[model samples]
Target: ILSAVDTFGFHLNALDLRQNSESFEAVLDELFAAAGVTAPDAGYASLDESAKRELLVAELTSARPLVFPWSQDFSADTERELGIFRAAAQAVELLGPGVVPHCIVSMTGTVSDILEPMVLLKEVGIISFNPAQQRLVGSVDIAPLFETIEDLKAGAEILQELWEVDLYRGYLRGREDVQEVVLGYSDSNKDGGYLSANWALYDAQLAIVKACDTHGIGLRFSHGRGGAVGRGGGPTYDAILAQPEGAVRGSVRITEQGEVISARYGTASTARRHLEAFVAGTLEASLLDTESLKEPERAYGIMRDIASLAGEKYAQLVRDDSGFIDYFTQSTPLHEIGDLNMGSRPTARKQTESIGDLRAIPWVLSWSQSRVNLPGWFGVGTGIMRWAGEDETRWQDLRKLYQAWPFFRSVLDNMAQVMGKASMNLAQIYSTLVDDPTVSQRVFNTILDEYELTKEVFFRITGHDSLMAGNERLERSVQRRYPYLLPLNAIQIELLRRYRAGEDTFLVSKTIQVTMNGLATGLRTSG
Candidate 1:
């Protein structure tokens, strides 16, 4: 806490309290009932976006409080959430502005989702309209986190709608016309694949930029990146530079979690290096027009094609294949990983076979443990192959694009690093753990085929015969780690075999857990 205060002053790190938008709606429903008044237009949930916006605008524009201390009748969860907002209001009075700068609503799909939190903030006295001044007063920014691919695609439309409302437009003026939107890297990647996720995010940002421009709003993007490629992890500097033009817009935020936090900030010198890289990258992205060389429309079209083809291929293997779940459970240390307790967040959103329920960290970590790193490179090869085919000209165009486009270059480079670290032989060994030989062979063969194709495509684009060819230092460093990783992989496979064969003992489970940690450390990635 002291360190945070020292670095960021009394406001500290500016906590962003997040919850599902539905939860906020439920809270508002209870609040309405407790106040003994019908909602402005029926119940909050039943109201359409236009009604909700109109109601919210009326409430925010009034000086009257929605809920008072005497009327604080609500369920335990609702009360707790309200108490948090009330505390935040108090904190602003005590610690000054910036203590809690944002209340992020996750799974935000509609204008109502954004307005729901704003109403709660008004109830807590964090936001109010001044009739004399004709403006809203508030310190916290209510950011909507768009997670799934569908949400990302619709992000611009949602923001545009929010800005169109006269009341919300006035509120934006109070915020100096600045709006923050969070894009979820992990969820989208899990929903689609790496290529589709990247393309969706890029297109979303482009559309959002245009929307913000049209509304005369300053846009700030918060990237929900994780410590794996599937979760938008890569060299921080390159990643920032690779963002869609105007996406950075002088300010940006990204989540650094798990091993990434430690790896970047564990030491003073390392932290300095990482911070310097971030600052430099941000400045370059904000000031420089990196998209001049490539035609934006042309690039977008190519990426769209690639993402569509790649996403389909990825869905075929992971989603369409019924035996994939069994293969994943057997081939990787997913079950053991849960017991490792590496994080406070639940491994799965719910108990289900659906990939959407599984968090991205474990998704990529599982693949990393098996030495396949499938999440990073799976559908990319197929996508490239389908696009290029036997056309030498198309292949040449890709190489030129890789050279000129920061986004394309970064994607290929990151994939190369992940692919270089993968061990097909080790991956094959893990495939044996699958119960049925036919299923195992079928999936494994597909993976192997894709892996080979990915390598071929990567080399073709990079003009290199081998992975990490130009960066010998990094290549050597990764190569050195591979031999050490083999023992842990071997141990993990044996332990998985024993444990799955009904030897589910404490020691066996513990060993498998330890091996998982070792592999993640050695690989410098977590799912």
Candidate 2:
């Protein structure tokens, strides 16, 4: 029985329901209108941040349900949103609190953003507020996901402001005075580069830990990591061990989705290994058992400088270059991915061609499929090189930093793992798919140059003879898989060319999809 219990998690992974904050705002807008609540210009969605916070708290203070779900007609979107919450509430009532434990607010930017979902959930009775008793009771946790680089930088400040709200504080007290903060890895990676995103997350954790400590609140970090390095995928043990001290607090939740779920936990042995990693990582992180640098402040300053310079370089290609979108869409299988019935989720949030609108899964997956792995290492070379410059002392400092700082080392090592798997030769072949010679040549050349620079700087800093030098497990994994992956990539390229040139046939599309699934399985972090 004990062995069976260990092998099987009976609803061990709690369902975490998530949606964009805008979805909550829209639902509230419809609900307010239905309830005949009078407000200024735009009802609920148009209120300023402060007003939204106060109004939401006041609404919570009233102990009244905002919606007459049976009586009022709601927009399809609103109904859909309400339907999900209602279903979740019903499930919790029937199956107990373990059925759906969290309602996460994605793209959460403000105090109001965090409160919005709580308000909606209150209307459905998932949470209750007693105005007369000044009490709040919640059946589920409300976790705010901070995704963008800007949002990550402001997370601590937002939390500080949030905890000041008496009602929110009261709600926290009801939930054991704990706050679960989700750090978004994919969006932050796409917004900046690998180095910048990693640094931002680490720095934000340092600040947030301090803030939570000041408030005497228990803090739990739920990492919104994907299966790819660009999406916060790496060696789980190392990644957790590298976190800022006190960030873990013996409780950390790392998301596992798509290929990662299979890659990490497909088999019994692999599953046990990863579970051990999580347990070990938490214990080590909580105990302050990891190594620490003597000059943390100095290392922090150096990292900030590197990340700033690197971010500019990343923006130069991904954000500033107008031709980049065309280059990316043309070269990679991004559009074709949209055609595949991967799941119920769309490839993008909107039909528009904005990078921000493109979900991070597809963005990173596209790059991964093409084998450029651009999101993993782009701009890092420029960041490190430009910051170090011609100063030999600075170069030595970086090498020492990599040796001493767990966070910095993890950043470089993970990049090495991704870069080791990436083949510029294969990427160059994919570049031929681009129509415009100028765009293809310019972008490819820039990528190759950075690849060379990044590899050089990576080896120099780590004092490793080759990429994946110390990581024999990854090296062996790559060696075994590369032979199989290369041919699939080549075939995929030809198939893409044929299909794009109007071959539009069942066989052609089918073959292309076969190669896609094959690569995704082999890459493990493909999507």
Residue pairs with clashing backbones, model 2: none
| CA shift of 249, model 1, Å | 2.3
lDDT by residue (380-450, candidate 1, tens digit) is: 99999999899999888888889888998888888888888899999999999999999999999999999
Best by lDDT: 2
Cα displacement (Å) at residue 283, model 1: 1.7
- Off by more than 4 A, model 1: 1-7, 36-43, 61-73
Provide the RMSD of all predictions against the true structure, rounded to 1 decimal.
Answer: 2.7, 2.1
**Candidate 2, residues 1-527: lDDT per residue as tens digits?**
78755654354556878999888888887787677664535688877898888888887777567775376677899989988988988877876777688889999899998888888788888888776768778878889999999999999999989889888888888888899999999999988988899999999998999999988999999998988999999889999999988898878998888877877888999999999989999998999757578888898999999999999999999888878888898899988888888866787888736588788888988898899999999999999999998899999999888888788888999898899888899999999999998999999999999999999998778889889997998799889999999999999999999999999999999988888888888887674
Candidate 1 positional error at 118, Å: 1.1
RMSD score of candidate 1 (Å): 2.7
Model 1: lDDT of residue 223: 93
